[model samples]
Target: MSNMHASKLFDVKDKVVLVTGGGRGIGEMIAEGYVSNGAKVYIASRDIKACEATAARLNKQGPGKCYAMAADLSKYEDIVKLIDELSKKEQALNVLVNNSGANWGAPLDEYPDAAFSKVMNLNVNKVFTVTQKALPLLRNAQKKDGVARVINIGSVNGVDPPALETYAYSASKAALHHLSRVLASRLGPEGITVNTLACGPFQSKMMAATLEKFEESIVGGLPLGRIGTPEDVSGVCLFLSSRAGAYTTGATIPVDGGSLVKAKL
Candidate 1:
């Protein structure tokens, strides 16, 4: 095949995609990538205003379209409502990005029970619930030669010990990574793929405080000598969602600017 044909391998044209917590950060970057590539994208979040604003902005730059909806994934009821709304909007879903997550930081002894529970509920439990509920839609979206995709947003903290005190967050992400493997094995025969993106650091709201506090040290320590960019993440997401990554599943890919590699060194 020609290079042009190979380039088309990553095209997600007309794919129906849902990105949880797609209002900002990595989720927004992923959503924008799909929208730019002609995928019909639905970005959801607890904050409707943020989702709407992001959708509006992405739509202007799109070959596809972006829609916004509000749903708090921490609540099972809200997850169901979001699915129902999505079902009304589209007959099937080609991609599901479980990007809605939470994190809490404090000294181990000072980390309250509520904080731990909240992080686990949002990061681990909700991700499972949302994926489970979306299975039917995923199945519906599966093409005879194409597979539906489930991309979970994990963290390097799950792979390596945290540099700071974020115990619950790390544990939840570790669980998510494991769950992705399990789901991949279960969903493989059904023409679906499940994978996790173990991200390092980026300029997201979640990392804003940490980056501000230790940007110099973090950047200097990284093997790549810089933080990750939206393009770095979005490119990987597109690859995974497109035919280029059709044969891959149950894999934990680190889009961490070699942070994980340096951790062991």
Candidate 2:
């Protein structure tokens, strides 16, 4: 590919995108990346005000636009309502980024059954249901030559379990990664691509407490010698959503700056 062609390969301009849990943290980073690049983005979360605030903040920056929607994705009806509202405005969706998730931390014996259930329900189960309900829009966006992208945000902890005792959190991410692979097999024939982004620690709401305490240790531990920034995950997402990554599917691509590599060393 020529320079122009190569540049165009990573282009996501004007594409329609929906990012769940896009209120803050990694999801917000990803959303801003797309919006800045001229992709119309819809960010949905249980926190309507937060989503709206993010949408407003991004919209101010502009060539691409962003809209906000409220959906407690943990519930089936709310998922349907969100899709219904989106369906009212747009007929197609080019990129669907499932970033909404939950985490539960507890010791092995102290882990509550209810907490486990809640974590599993929000982190694993809801992702499936949201993807299921959005199939029509995803299909609408698919092309014979180009496939729609479904990037599932997962954790590096899923691949290499950390010392932390967030049993359900790790397990849920692992399930999500496998789920992406399985869905890839089924959705491939239908002109949609599925993949998991096995991400390392990023400065996000989820990792605030851990990072606050162990920022130095975590930085020292990583081969990259730094934690992830927005560009780290956003760049990978652009690659996967654009023409460049059309052929790549059913794969777990890491944005961990070689954390997994450091783990074995």
Candidate 3:
């Protein structure tokens, strides 16, 4: 395939994207990709200092500018405030990536109620709330190139439960995946696209901790030799949020390196 043809498949130039939990790890990588591609990127998270640091570093890069905001995704009021504040600065949000979430792992009998609630509040509730608050901006944004996109960060644990027990985290992510499908159906006609990225074992803070305790033998079970990377995860997000991804909605794309095909037995 020609370079131009491949380039035409995905382009986010001159667009505005808002990414939650974008100060570091997977979110930061995705933000960098968008900014490098000529799309103005806004990163939102609870850490004001981290946000500022990332914004400062990214602002020095070319093509697109980076902005940062401090917003706790677990709270509805905070999301409202975040949207209101962004509206004051930018015209509208062209893309929203709900990448902020917390996970808890415990055996079913040992899991506490707080584990479920805490993860759900940030992973699920916040997704719905933030999307609702950003609706006006998304609804009014120009769709000449493509409809506004909403990319929810999910987990492969939601699809196939590994022996490692992450009861609440897996359940929450599963619910989030389902929620994306539901929202996609309702928001499609409004020129908005919704989808979820079910990521597998990546070199993330969450994964590092899990890796220390888990058996290394499982590594050989993966079809891909190594675990996932920031590029592995962010590449998919960029595609789903760019013009090339306009036609994809109500979908759950995996960045798992064929791990989803592993034998359940």
Which numbered prediction scores highest in lDDT against the true structure? 1
In order of listing, the candidates' clash counts read: 0, 0, 0
Clash number for model 2? Answer: 0
Off-target runs (Cα >4 Å) in candidate 3 are 1-4, 142-145
- Residue 55, candidate 3: Cα error in Å is 1.8
lDDT of 2 by residue, 1-265 (tens): 5745966888998899999999899999999999989999999998999999999999999889999999998898999999999999988889999999988898898999999988889888999998998899899888532558899999898899888889999999999999999999999999899999999889988899999999998888789999999999889999999988989999999888788888552
Q: How high is the CA lDDT of each candidate model?
A: 0.92, 0.91, 0.84
Poorest stretch of ten by lDDT in candidate 2? 140-149
| Angstrom error at residue 228, model 1 | 0.8
TM-score of each: 0.97, 0.96, 0.93
lDDT (tens digit, per residue) of candidate 1 on 166-219:
999999999999999999999999989999999989898999999999999998
User: 1 or 3, which is superior by TM-score?
Assistant: 1
lDDT at position 256, candidate 1:
89
Please give the RMSD to the true structure for each candidate, in Å.
Answer: 1.4, 1.5, 2.1
* Decreasing TM-score order of the candidates: 1, 2, 3
lDDT for 62 (candidate 1): 89
